[model samples]
Target: MKERVLDLVFLIGVLFKGLDGLLELVGGAVLLFVTPGQVQRAAERVTARELAEDPHDLVANLVVHGAAHLHGRSVWFVAAYLLLHGLVKLAIVVALLVGTRRIYPWAMAALGAFLAFQLYELIVRPSVAVAVLTVLDAVIIWLTWREWRRGRELRTTWRQTVAWVFRRPQPREA
Candidate 1:
């Protein structure tokens, strides 16, 4: 039952990671073609709707602020950021799903680094999205570490069993 639950968690992480990557990729591509004015206009519409529903919605306020900041900004930097992030995430998800033992440690390290960055960003910006992502990354890191340890133990046990079975018998001729 415990193993099943762990498997489920890992599966959910994989799915979420893949979806996140896809969204980033698509968003980046869209940003390449869409003008900042268009983005701001869309954000304004969404923000207005959200604020109408909740007069004091923090996210809506953030959206308005972000849109205002985007008005004259160069979006290439953001586009590049999104594309790079998306590609890395997709690669990690694929590696994990393929059960690459050597990749496990690297994956954990990459995720840990990203998590640390996100935590730092949260400290500076304090967004709900970043906080949720940090939590998800923490869960994935734990699950990946657990799976890596289990794989190592299994390999060690198999080696020991094989060695014992194939051991040469001492000379018994009397």
Candidate 2:
């Protein structure tokens, strides 16, 4: 029974990693074909806006509208975006494969689920993805605490070494 459960968990992790890879491909294509012109046009619009007293409004307006205008540029932006996007996806695939080899099974499972939750709206059901993110966030936080503790221990050791080296030696004579 335990073996079967472990197998199931491992299978789920592999499946989620595959799913994330697929989504990254699709997202990269979309971003490449759509982002440059939109980004350029948005930049132009921000420049066109009447000068405002508060910089916040200008910043907010650009953030809210720039991405909505993805059709503003030619194919060059698409080409560059897709190229960079592909490189990023390749790096992620390498990480996933490396992680599977080096990390514990449960940690691998958590990593896969975390990626799925983060990309939920893109790959899985949006509502379900949001729920997964909420639940997985607690797990991620706990994992982060372990990492933080390890870092603290290292820092303490480093501090001790520095203190020993830097402290003035006691005076031998009055």
Candidate 3:
């Protein structure tokens, strides 16, 4: 059914979000533990072969350039951001998968705040990766909203069914 398909897509999105969060956690740890100079050196070492293969490789050059500019303050900021964001996202994912009514609004609110921040970032400083993330978050928000609405409808139906089942017989009619 269409509803099942939508639910499946939502589940997939949540899993993807969790995976991204896990990657962010690992990246944060790496950034936290490694010195800027060491990271720059590692980037150079890792990209040397690729650069050699393709002298004008965009990705290799970007990595080299980005690593070269990594500063201590920026590294700390990014590490903290990643670790916190990852932890929050993983927690939200767990809440979403558990099928609870009360948690959805909180999760949606958290995601909405993230989306707002992302949009502001996009306006101030745009990047392909950030744009992709923004889009994904938007889609997830819409899907989550749909799920919340569906849950409300299901709850209403369940309550009505229970009420009807428990309704008293009319003595006057009898």
Candidate 4:
């Protein structure tokens, strides 16, 4: 039951990351085809509705203000960032799900780096979503390490069992 729970945790992490990557990929592709003017107009409409619904929402206000300030180059940058980020995450998810022992350490390193960056950003910006994601990343890192150790132990035990099974019996005493 404990092993099953561990496997479930690992699988959940992989699925979450895979889904996030898919969203990023789809969003980036869609953004690439949208004109800056369209984005600005859509942002304005959404902002107006959000402000009308609740004028005191700081996040909505900030998003509206930022949207107003975006340029064509900013849109392009966003698209490129989403695409690259999605690709890398998807690759990591695949490697992890495939149980690539060599990639586990690197995956943990990558996640740690991202988590550190997110922590810094959370400190600077203080978003609830970023904070939640940072926590999730930390958990995933722990799960990955646990899974790796479990795999190593399983492999070692399997090797020992195989050796024991295949070993020839000692010859009769002289």
lDDT of 3 by residue, 38-135 (tens): 99999999999999999899779978987898897999988998898888888888766554767778878988998998999899988666788899
Report RMSD for candidate 3. Answer: 10.1
TM-score of each: 0.75, 0.31, 0.76, 0.68
Model 1 C-alpha lDDT per residue in residues 1-174, reported as the tens digit of each score: 566556556666767887898899898888888888888888888788778889899888877776667633458877876887888888887776664588888888988988998999899989887898899999999987887887843234334545555679989998
Q: Where in model 3 is the C-alpha error above 4 Å?
A: 48-62, 152-174
In model 3, what are the clashing residue pairs, if there are any? none
Q: Candidate 4, after superposition: displacement of residue 90 in Å?
A: 0.4
True-vs-predicted CA distance for residue 119, candidate 1, Å: 2.1
Candidate 3 TM-score to native: 0.76
lDDT of 4: 0.76
> What lDDT, from 0 to 1, does candidate 1 have?
0.77
Kindly list the per-residue Cα lDDT of model 4 for residues 53-150, writing each as its tens digit: 99988777777766676678988887887787777788888776554578888888888888888899898978777888899989989987886776
Clashes by residue pair, model 4: none
- Which candidate wins on TM-score? 3
**Could you tell me how far off, in angstroms, the CA of residue 157 lies in candidate 4 after the best superposition?**
16
Which residue ranges in model 4 land beyond 4 Å of their true spot? 40-69, 152-174
Model 2, span 52-76: residue lDDT tens = 5455564545554544545545344
In terms of TM-score, how similar is model 1 to the real structure?
0.75
Every candidate's lDDT: 0.77, 0.48, 0.81, 0.76
Better of 1 and 3 by lDDT: 3
